[model samples]
Target: MATHFHKKPNLYPAHVQLKVSDLARSIEYYTTIIGFKVLQRTGSEAYLTADGQTILVSLIEIQNAQPLQRGFAGLYHLALLLPSRKDLGNIVQHFVNLNIRLGAADHDVSEALYLNDPDGNGIEIYIDRDESEWTWFDDGQVNMVTEQLNFQPILTAADGNWTGLPAETVMGHVHLSVANLDKSEQFYTNVLDYNVVTRYGTQALFVSTGKYHHHFGLNTWNSNNGQAPEENMVGLKSVTIVLKDEHYAEEVKQSLNANGFIVENFAEAPAYGGAQLFSTVDPNGLRILFTLDGE
Candidate 1:
C-alpha cells in the first residue's frame, strides 16, 4: 500500500477594497491624479475601476466610522498595471503636472511610480518589462533593485498617450508592512503557498505565483508589533478573492493554522489566488491576503 497526502494550496486576492472618508475628494483624486475611472457614485459612497475590472471601492462616510489612526492594518499599496513604459511615462507626466508627490524608481524588471491616494492609501503605478529582460538569481528570484528612472524621453514625446497603447492589464501586485516578518511570511507562504521570490533582510518577504514577479509582499518597515488600525484613518479596507474550489480554500485554512498562523475569513475560504482568499494582518499591522482564481 502507498501512502498519499493532500497538498497545501496558494491564494491570490479576488478584489481588494478600500473605505475612504470623503467620496467626492477620493473620486477627484483617483480619477484625475491616479487615472482610475469612476464607475459610479452615490452620496458619500463611490466606486472606482482600473481597466474595467468589476468591484466597488466603497468610500464610506467617516462621520459614523471609527477615528483614523496611523500605522494600522489597512491598505498598504495597490499596484496599477500599465501596458508599456510609454504608458507609464504619460501617466508620470500627468502626475508631474499636478505635483502629486510622486516617487519614481526602476526595478530592473519594472518601472514604478509611487504615490498616495486621496484617502492616504499607498498607490503604485507601474509597467513591467518582458521576461527576456528580467534578471533572475540562481534560485529564480528576480534581481529586483531600484534604479533611477529617466522620464525625460517618454514625456517629451507625448501628452495623454497612455491609453493608446493596447495590452491586457490588471492589479499586478500589492506590497505591505506587517508587525512580524517571519509570521507574515509563514502566513503568505506556508499558509497561502505563495512562492517566496526574495527578501530584504529580516524586515521583508516577497512572494509570487506563476512567473509574474511578486503579487504579494510584506515587510516590517514600520509598525512592528502593531495593533489593528482604527476605522477612521484612510487605509486598506478589504481585499477581494476568487477561488478555484471550496476544498482549496479549506485546505489553505488548515495549512495556516498548522503553520501557527492567525487567519480570518468569511464563510468557507478556498484555495486559488484568483478564486479564494483570506484577508489577514501580519506582525506590522498591515493588511495581507491570499486569493484564488475563478473556476
Candidate 2:
C-alpha cells in the first residue's frame, strides 16, 4: 500500500503519547484488542507500531498516576485511520466477537468506531470516504456531519479475516478537549500555520495543513472553563506531528517564534527515536511536537 504521510511543509499527525497507570495491562490491551504490534519496550515505556515498523502510539508507565478526570483539557480521542472500509469492518467484527462495546458514527466523510482504552483514554478507528464523494462549500471548507452509521454495509465489506493493523494505517487525527476555542484556534492557525478547515458554532474547530479534512480537532464542548490535566493525571502526554525535513521543521519553528510562541528542543521527547524536535504547548496546555519524517 502507498504511504499516507503528507508531503513537505504539511504537518501531519504522526503519533500520540499517552500516560497510563498500568504498563502491563495497557500493553496487553493494545496488542490484543487494538491489534497493534509492540515495537520496543523500555524500562517504563512501550512503543507500538502498525505494520511492524511505523511507530504509532507510545505508552508511558506512570505508576500510581491519577485516573483521568471527567472535565479536563486533554485528549478527546486519538483517531486511527484504517486503509479501507474492509479493514475497518474486519476490526469491528473482531470487536463483536470479543464483546467489546463501541460507539459508531457516520461523519459523512468517514465511518468511525469509538472506544476507550483500559485507562479510559478515548480511541477512534475510522476509514475516510473517497475524496470524490466529499462535499465542499464555497467558503473553502469541507462539509462534515454526525449521523447514524449503517453497519450492515460495513459488515458486508468484511471477509472474516483477522490480522493486525495494515501498513497504510496511520494516525489520521487527534481530537482534543480544550478549555477555550478562540485561544486554541489562534494557536493552531497563527503559530502552527494550520488552515481552519471547518467550525461548529463557537464550540469546535477543525484545522488541517494539506486540506484533507482535519488533522486536529479542537472542541470545548465537554471542557468549557476546564483546567489542564494535573501532573499525575493519566491522559495525553503529548501529540507528535511529522514534518518533511529539518529545514521544514526550522521554518515552522521560525513561524512559531514570529507569532510569540515559545519553541524548545525537548531532548527527552518520546517519538521518532532521537530526531530533532520543535516542541511547544498550546493555549490549553497540550504539548505539540514537530519532527522530521525520518527520511
Candidate 3:
C-alpha cells in the first residue's frame, strides 16, 4: 500500500463512527466477517482495530435505532484499503468459502468488494494499484472508471489463508450520499481544500488531497435533494479526518469560520493523546471530525 496517501502531509480519513441497532450483533459481524478485533468496548459502543493499536471503525448502539434509510444523505460506504493484492485475494477467497455475497468492481484505479453490515451500513474493501499506473490529465482530473473486475487473477494471487484483516489495513476513503452535487463539491473543495480528482458526470464526483485517486466520493445518485437521516438511524454517525498537525487543524477551523460554518469543539479524549480536535457538518449534514494525527 502507499503510505504517503494515508500518512501526514496529506489529509485522509482516519476513522469512521457508525450507528448500529445492536452492538453485540454488529461486533460479531465486524470481527468475524470484516476481520477486525475489538480494541475497546463499553456498554453501547465498540471500537474496532485491525492492527490492535489504531482504531479504524467504531460502532455505537442507539436505543430503538431505525434501519438505514435510503434516499438520505449519509454514508454510501466506508472503504478499508488493504496492503496488497495478495491480501485482497485472501479476503476474497475467505468470503467465497463463507458464501458471503459481494459486489465487485474495478475502478481502473482500484479493485473493490462491497458488502453491508447487519445494520445495512455499506462497507468497501479494496486494494489500490500502484500510483505509477494511474492516469492523470492536464486538467487535474484523475481517470477512473467502474468496470467488471476479473476475479481469476486475484484468486490466483491468493495464498488461501484467511486469518483476518492485515495490520497494514487503513481507512482508505469515504463515499457519501449527498443531497446536492454543486453544494457538496463547493463545501468539500472550498472549505476542506480538497481538489476534484474525478467526476462521474453530474451524479458523482471524487475529491482528494495530494492527488490520491480519491479520499472522498460525493454522490447524489439516490439522495438528490434528500434530507439527512434522523439521528437515531442506523447509518453513519461521523467521519474523522486526520490533519497533519495542530496548526493545520487551526487553519481549517479558521476557514470554516470565515465561510460562516459552525464549528463545534468537543473535549479532547485521552485516546487521541491530547491532539487538537473539532467537528463541523458538511452541506449534506454529514458530521466530520477534524483532528491532528496523534503520532
Candidate order by decreasing TM-score: 3, 2, 1
lDDT against true structure, model 3: 0.90
| lDDT tens digits, residue span 166-241, model 3 | 9999999999999999999999999888999999989999999998999999999879999988999989988988
- Model 1, 84-142: lDDT tens per residue? 66677777777677777888888887778888765567878777777678877888787
Best candidate (score: lDDT): 3
* 1 against 2, candidate with superior TM-score: 2
Q: Which has the better lDDT: candidate 1, or candidate 3?
A: 3
- After superposition, the stretches of candidate 2 with alpha carbons farther than 4 Å from their true spots are 1-7, 267-274
Per-candidate TM-scores read 0.79, 0.94, 0.97
Runs in model 1 deviating more than 4 A are 1-11, 56-58, 64-71, 156-159, 162-168, 257-295
* Cα error of candidate 1 at position 85, Å: 1.9
* Residues forming the 10-long window of minimal summed lDDT in candidate 1: 1-10
Question: Against the true structure, whose TM-score is highest?
Answer: 3
The model with the greater TM-score, 2 or 3, is: 3
Each model's C-alpha lDDT? 0.62, 0.85, 0.90
**What is the C-alpha lDDT profile of model 2 across 104-180, one tens digit per residue?**
99998889999999889999999999877889898989899999999999999999896877777888899999999
Residue pairs in steric clash, candidate 2? none
